[model samples]
Target: MLEGTEAVLAAQLRRLLPHLDERQRRLVMGAAAGVLGRGGIRVVARAAGVVESTVSRGAGELDRGPELSGRVRAVGAGRKRLVEADPGLIPALLALVEPDQRGDPESPLRWTVKSTRNWPPS
Candidate 1:
């Protein structure tokens, strides 16, 4: 009966993935995995195509109650912005956009005109 329930839950999660946001999906998977008890992380992770760590974190969140806001991902979640990830990125962009230097000819933005208001503040 447990195996049958796991299979059913896995199928439901797979079908629901496209419609639900990351947090919602994780919650559903975590809840289902929690119901299965022991070894549920591995089972649900395989079924959901997510890592065990993700399911583990989801389980942790479930235990902690509603901590997240309206957003799908938690605050400061996902990849860091390019500027934050690479200190050199802003300098490289500045060098390209500054006067007296030719920007990358291959860049699609090279042909497009942009207003100063649209540019990021230095």
Candidate 2:
């Protein structure tokens, strides 16, 4: 449908988010949710193309004291990368992916012939 309410709101948020830093984006999205009141977090999040938690953070921020600095996030606030935090992860992943250059026997492609005829299933 042309000019639907949800579509217009989503477009606005998509257009706006790129211009804002992380914290500002959260606050803006949160405010949008706050305006809607109750379940606004879900609506604003979907419209803003962000997770519900992000919107929730913004809403929580609104209820608290003013921001103290220009920091976008708290120290070590987010999750760590799998590769960085666990060295064993690489070995484990490589073992699964045929680390020694030999193919894994359990792979789905193990029995499939590597040919163009097999590629498109002619």
Candidate 3:
């Protein structure tokens, strides 16, 4: 039988969480639920997803000892800092869309307005 979302989410959390403190357990589980509730970090962010800085802070707390989550560092592999260093990425990617481009005429890739936003349909 298919598992419910909460059950599936709990199972996923169990895999990611080995040994966790009480607070860490709550926070981490909450984070996982947050992921399921919305979409991802960016979506959560757009929804004022409780501020990534808070999540980062919680992650810091969770990383204080080996009892919660893992002791592995550099989760982003240093790419986060690198991306932050370059500020032109957002504008550059946005410039790829042309206003005149209408909906796709077959399977062709053409941008269109979706949800009042210009985004390529998936």
Choose the strongest candidate by TM-score: 1
Sorting all predicted structures by lDDT, with the top scorer first, yields 1, 2, 3
**TM-score of each model, in listed order:** 0.60, 0.58, 0.24
Q: Tens digits of per-residue lDDT for model 2 on 27-118?
A: 88888888878777887787777789999999899889578876888987888998889879978865654533445667645333345565
Candidate 3: tens digits of C-alpha lDDT, residues 41-108: 33323333246554445555545644544543434553465448888876665565545557756755
lDDT of 1 at 37: 92
For residues 50-122, could you state the per-residue lDDT of candidate 1 as single tens digits? 9988888888879999864567776777998888779899789867656543468666555334457866646
In candidate 3 the C-alpha lDDT for residue 51 amounts to 60
- The CA lDDT of each predicted structure is 0.78, 0.77, 0.50
Candidate 1 at 74: error in angstroms?
3.5
> By how many angstroms RMSD does model 3 differ from the true structure?
16.7
Error (Å) of candidate 3 at residue 103 is 93
TM-score of 1: 0.60
For candidate 2, what is the lDDT? Answer: 0.77
